[model samples]
Target: MSARDSATVRIDASDTLRFNALMPGELQERARMRARPDFPWVARQAAITLSEAYRGNLLLTRLLNDRGRVALALLMLDMHFEQPDAPGLTTGRLKAEAVALDICSPGRVGAILAAFRLFGLVAPAPDLDGRRRRLVVTERLLAIHRERWRTILQSLALVLPEEGERGLHHIEDPAFLAAFVHALLEPMRAGWRPAFDVPAIAHFADRDGGMLIAFALFGTGPTGQPLSISQLARSFRISRSHVVGIVQNAAEAGLVRRVDEQGSRGPGVLPQPALTEALEAFVALVLVRQAVAVRRGLAAIGVA
Candidate 1:
């Protein structure tokens, strides 16, 4: 890839949050202020925590239906204890408010509540009897979110585009992006494994991975089989160079092989059996990630 292409795939810390651009003077002042001796680490920590939570939530929403997305956001916003009147809203009241927001069915509320409790993301407040108490977010969950966001952002940065560049904006708000980063990084917490190969694919796809994968898998041949270079380019709406590059990469990875070369069109073939198996595995992985994100989003709302 050209440097422009590589730059197009880089992600930055700014991608994790949505804030107004800072004037040079203001930025310098803020940097100096952060160097102060008395600055509270807790505040900095909280900011990081919130940013990661927002990113995670965003990824979760992408995996869920509209109702699930709205429901999760409402629950998180409602559960935020920093608001002045937050102390007065009981769990039941919050649940009712979520319903009013048209986020979820009343019947599903308790299941969500139970799941959050089990995950220790939220705990019942002390006053209104445990069952009806306000929801309190746990610090551990915040830490988990932070780590997850870091991983996702790091991996995505390798594949996502740069600002003001020609590429898909996989994430908008920094907070939401951070959350997704967090979710993507979770498996790494235990230890490195082979499944982390998605990052490699992301790096390969860069800004066009989704479209590329879709075309490669579904739009290539007439009967849904692999196609020749020209056919792949036409079906995928990409340049022949790009198709050649992708195929070459797949071949290097042992994910595909040239099956025949007799036709005037050059070669005609299909994904190697190994490639097919790999694709199946990747699809399964994506599905699992989506499911996990949905569960996390629902849990955030206080649903199973």
Candidate 2:
């Protein structure tokens, strides 16, 4: 179903209260700073989407690493913007794009390429380029790359119809709005810079690894009250098992502790002070990039 069709229902007061409560103080602060007045709603929706999508990343999270994911994006961009980039992707071209985008270093790019090649995502190009060794693109990633953007666009659409005038015009212009939304979300994701250097357990990664971490560390009520597992699941529409596993995993990793009878409502998940500090550093990195992107976007349209 179209996002418009799916989100046609009005957001109930209870849902509004719950969702707003889910937003961390830090994220709310960033939204206040970066959200365009013309489209103040975009910042909140985008933040929610980023958290949701990053958490919703089931397959891709396990299939690719941080840099490998970038490499895959570079390959698809070749198909997207440049001509003659179809049917195949090359390390040299991927390297240039990666460097231009500041996604990774040349050495890291090489490793990414090698990893993709090792998997079946890429293959040796035809005999024509024997010396240079270009790589052919596989159908394996096409549906994934295309669908992800489609999903993002639909998510934005569900929000664009919201009570915001600034973004309304762009919504009419699909191309413009797509670019605009992309600009808004990219920094949020890239700035997050994925927490794990190594992949989590297959099942955990299959679910929402990033979401788990965020909840494990920052899941709380609007007034900073710790929420019980049932409360967290109810508010987020996440499964109880998922919440349990996430908390258990975080505890295993020493990122948080489950304190029995900790909060007025019920048992609460408390952050390990040392780990919370480290996680905040990651948030700081993303916030800086998001702020810059928001500024550039506003400036582009001659808005303050």
Candidate 3:
């Protein structure tokens, strides 16, 4: 099977597991709701991280997908935010959390857990049901987390140079740690839906490679700049032809248009005004909503 086909099939398998949701996506929706009162900080952290990545050129769908897979793996080891005062989180509960967060499926979650066991990132432990398997987070994964933290800090520096190194933390701060856990994942907001939503995508009907291609434009080719297919392919790690196809698709989809009398504008892929407007509007909405979530959540944490 083709790589794209294989990936789509895997996503389809996850969709099947999600069929049991209370109402199509009840688990994810309820998780967002439950999070509001109990874990507002988590939601806000996710929003901030996503916004930062979007406004900057550091994130892509491939990186976002990898982060989701890693998040599921870490959840298996209960390495989410590392708050000792809170109760322990089990693998089973984490699977439920994944569903509730609309991040992944129980099957995908189990696959990551099993992979971690094979990689020695976790060790098997005795369970109440002796035959059942349970795993603990190992030091190796902690080390990996440290490395990932440094990488994020570096990426932040590229875009948010003004912040310098002050925002970097030792993973002990709950808010800082929470941001790491959700560096690539975006929060699912209600009523703000658009046909082509998701800030990760410069423009798209849904999240896909096309979206990733669009995202690359920001990192490599900002608005009003002349972006060549070769430049986009090299920057995004995709083929030149593929980038051309995506540009054509985006143009056909009305996310982009041509300059110079609907003809070639010197081998450049121009971003449409509508897409820029849409993204700006989306970012504004996120900052506003996340501010509210943060303000209300602060009282609970005694951080007024």
Candidate 4:
């Protein structure tokens, strides 16, 4: 299979596993409910509740997919804070709490903890006595929570036309959303530098060749401006054909856009404002996927 096909297969398998892990017994029920015509209204109510909690700076909004799991996780955190003397309240303790709360099996808690830690939603740290480790909420945790909540609210408002009784007063500004998306893309963006070889793309091209092409074409260009296809090819030692193909794909995916379009003879350019909005939405979706993937990956590895 092609590299892209392989990635697709892997992602599909991962998604299936994730869905199964999240609601093993309730999938059919959930699907049935969601298929109902009034499901959007239900989702809107849930979104409003979640958004309110997020606006209040509640830490529980960080966990996606399962509300029960989030509640259990927060309860575990609270339990740690209230009963420092409680045994089995370590990372292990949180997992046990999740199980007690019927969020997941006792054996699955470790995986859940790992998933939360991977995304910076929670951090493993030494307790006050410095003897055992405990989970502490991180700033990124709150940021992700707030972002997801906003996305949920926006999605609900968009999906449920009748549910828009009032607008959120503290909705995130476009600039904030753009910055959040940029932050999430940091790893992908940093990999485009010349000095650092992106091993992740090695399956597609030679060492540093992929980075060179990506940087010139996708990375900031002349005077820190976005580069055009022809200019990118000249800098990367690649053919215009290759550069054109890559740029086209990136443009289609809403990643890169042509800056100067008046004199252009190629595909139409993406406007700055539209690109920014698309990137923000892409980042929000990615964050949710990553959170769910981490949770599932951990469970598959028997960590949870």
Candidate 5:
């Protein structure tokens, strides 16, 4: 099998151990969902929702803004959900697991955790062992996760109403929340990058506010009309230079193009067709994955 096929298998495998043989069917579902006439709109709205979510929030933008930091944050929550006891959720263990999963460096993970604690997203858990400090997810953090999950489920509802509604119905249930988080984290733990099919997205997916910048610039459609640098920077809580750097990198990769010579002041940054298609595909795949995850979460809690 080709590497793409191999990645497909691994991604599907992460969903459910008993459902291994259903990999082929999952791929079919992904394709069918993508082929839908409304798929592009759904994808765009989802991406916009996710991207806009981080806008105007300084602490959130700093902690969970980029793809890597987002994964790191989710990993912390997933580990807590999977193992809430001592040794299960600690700074050392979280850092180690992050390194093992290639999510980020130990130092970065530690720094983020410090920020999380300072911001009240996480707090020290009571443990008998003094040598290792245990961490616990705060209501603040859980609320953030719930909001993010709700954004995803809302998008899923556009395509798969039944599954999406069911998920939203139990969004606050601890059991369902735990299972849902684990389902989402499993693929990441297994090294599944959402942009696997659209490699060009890595240019935007890696930087802080990169994908969000794309969403802001691209608007709700593929026009990719120009927007002001100051506006983009303020929206994502980044500097003008940062936004310009992301745009320049994307332009070099042919994922986007500048139509004017205005440079950082306010150039006509248009997203190329390739970038639009890639983002659409990535969004569709995310919806599919979340749909399956919702089912898994519902099943885990006997919700049917």
Candidate 6:
């Protein structure tokens, strides 16, 4: 469904109301933004920005790519800001928070944090209370977060120039970044997903390396060559079978189709209209949500 088609497509009233509960008037805002005449081009530009940023940091990106890992990373930063003087990001606390968000299991949190430590994204902090290990968000982690935020703000800037530019300018300011993270996480804690409105790619967004695949597919225009399973697996550092499984499931869901049904043509997957529209709309909605967060962050620092 293209943005134009979204104008005519019937949205479930209940879903709109549910989303609106978290971000007031967000569903309507997303609809309006998506309905814009220039939205398609903006979405494409934003997709390129996102794709380049994702590819720029392959290892850390892979570690923090999925829905669960993303939530965990942001939650750690949020808690760290909330209590800079105290032990905020303990394994137990993080695990409980992850469980509350229903995005990951406690055991998974442990493994993710271990990977963070192993990758030098986080380090041990002094335990003020003499019990429970405390982890501090390292500068490496902060740099990764800043790059991610900057990439999103750059994409958002394409659609809403002033707000996005302002965010990009003040992103390095501790106050602005702290406020932005809080604003971004509040809705997420309430279970607002970036691709929630587009159900076709919801599963993709949730899985590890799944979203990268979706974005790569969306970047390939009608004339561009499709991505093969081997390409995706190598690019994302995931197993070949994993890519095959993801593509197979997406094909079953009508999100993608094999370029050549017969073995003679080769092994590449094409993004169907379902995927293109969903990915475009996903980009639009994310920019809309980020605009809201940017305003909140800007407002916190007394910026208009």
| lDDT, candidate 5, 1-304, per-residue tens | 2222322332244445434343336667888998899887888888778778878988667677777888887777776776445355788898888889777788988888888989999998777877877788899988987898899899999999998889889999888877887887876775666555556667776787887887665554455346666778888889889888888877877777776656666555777777777787777777787888888889989876
Q: What value does the lDDT take at residue 277 in candidate 3?
A: 45
True-vs-predicted CA distance for residue 7, candidate 3, Å: 19
- lDDT to native, each model: 0.41, 0.46, 0.45, 0.41, 0.76, 0.78
Please report how far candidate 1 places residue 290 from its true position, in Å. Answer: 1.1
By TM-score: ranked, best first: 6, 5, 3, 2, 1, 4
What's the lDDT for residue 109 in model 1? Answer: 66
Model 2, TM vs. native = 0.41
Better of 1 and 6 by lDDT: 6
- Residue pairs with colliding backbones in model 4 are 107-304, 108-304, 109-304, 110-303, 110-304, 111-303, 111-304
Name model 4 segments beyond 4 Å from true: 1-63, 76-89, 151-304
Deviating ranges (above 4 Å) for candidate 1: 1-225, 259-266
Instruction: Compute each candidate's TM-score over C-alphas.
Output: 0.35, 0.41, 0.48, 0.30, 0.88, 0.89
Model 2 residue 157 CA deviation in Å: 0.7
- Which is the winner by TM-score between candidate 3 and candidate 4? 3
lDDT of 1 by residue, 208-287 (tens): 22224322542232254446776645543456676566666656655556555747676544555454444333433433
Model 6, span 226-255: residue lDDT tens: 777877777777787877878888887788
Q: Any idea how many clashes model 4 has?
A: 7
Model 1: per-residue Cα lDDT at residue 153: 36
Model 3: per-residue Cα lDDT over 1-304, one tens digit each: 2222222222244443543331244344333443344233322233334333433232233332243554455454344454544433456866787787655778867776666667676676555665444556666766655554444444333333322143343344556445434432323212112222333233342323454444344333243666666655665455777666667756765666544332353466676655554444443333333333333334334453
Candidate 1 or 3, higher lDDT?
3
| Clashing residue pairs for model 6 | none
Q: What is residue 105's positional error in candidate 4, in angstroms?
A: 1.7
How far residue 242's Cα lies from its native spot in candidate 4, in Å, is: 36
**Per-residue lDDT tens digits of candidate 2, residues 109-207?**
787667656666667756465666666656555445444444434433443322123343333332433344445445323432233211222113324
